[model samples]
Target: MRHARNNELTDRRSAASDAKAALLTAYRAAKTAAEPSRSARQAERISLVEAREARRAERERLKHEEQTRIVTLAAQKQAAIEAAEGAEIEARNSAENARISRVVEDEAARKAERDRRYAARKSRQA
Candidate 1:
């Protein structure tokens, strides 16, 4: 009887060990099955991050281009204003020179007439 009981005890221990091994195998299979889903989720996250970065880069590029265009237009406007001012100054200078020339011609004509009349009077006296 005691030997029979010892055999029964050994059978229970072996059965428990078999059950534990089966549970470990099922856990490993479940983890293996979930691996592909986890990997797919990670890939999707990486793609989303890359897309967001591309959008941000594009926005920055457009903003920089707009700023450059505005600066270029402003520079052109300033140059045009300066050119107009220079033309105005040149016109004023031309007008002043013409007025001075007319005054000089008038003075020379008066002097010539005075000299001619004095010479004629001296010839009559002689």
Candidate 2:
């Protein structure tokens, strides 16, 4: 019985050592095989990140351009409005000047008529 128990213990130790050696060999193979896959995945992720950043930058540029276009349009509209308002003011001033000239001419005609009537009446009395 003692010899049999010693044999069983030896078998267990040998099996455990063999298992350890097989696990080490498999780990070495997996380590060598995994490098290319890991590098490829990392490179792919970096490229995707770069593409997204470029797209974001392009979108920002387009947005800025749109804003600039809108501002330019607004400025043009403002200039047109100012020009139209200035023309309207000039027209009103010209109409008022014409009306004042007509009023002055009418007053002169009335004064001349009154002087002529006075001179004729004085001559008749003499």
Candidate 3:
């Protein structure tokens, strides 16, 4: 049943194609006849010019759209990369701060020890 339906569709499509082809041939013959009617010639010229202009405009619109999409995507990717770099820099700064804090603590402990010894010796001498 499916195959029969497909065959029917194919036949219908061919019939339409043939009809279209015949009409096109007849139109061409009428246009080229040794003495074409003034209206027929003018209509053909106007249609051809309009079709060409429409196609040119469509191509320009498609090209502009494609360029805009490419630029927008590139900017988004660049922004993502910058954000990642900023995060890495912030992590490095935090690590350095922690390291410096440890060093400062050790220096303060040494100063306290030195002061305690100096006071003890001066009291014994007095």
Off by over 4 Å in 1: 1-34, 116-126
> Which regions of candidate 3 are displaced past 4 Å?
1-39, 109-126
Candidate 2: lDDT over CA atoms? Answer: 0.96
Model 2 regions more than 4 Å off: 1-32, 120-126
The number of clashing residue pairs in each candidate reads 0, 0, 0
lDDT of each: 0.96, 0.96, 0.92
How close to the true structure is residue 74 of candidate 2, measured as C-alpha lDDT? 100
Would you give me the overall lDDT of model 1?
0.96
70-102, model 2: which lDDT tens digit per residue?
Answer: 999999999999999999999999999999998
Which predicted model would earn the best TM-score? 2
Q: Please, what are the lDDT tens digits per residue for candidate 3 over residues 1-126?
A: 999999999999999999999999999888677355777778899999999999999999999999999999999999999999999999999999999998998888898889889999999999
What TM-score fits each model? Answer: 0.60, 0.67, 0.53
Q: What is the lDDT of residue 115 in candidate 1?
A: 88
| Candidate 2 clash pair list | none
Preferred candidate (TM-score higher): 1 or 2: 2
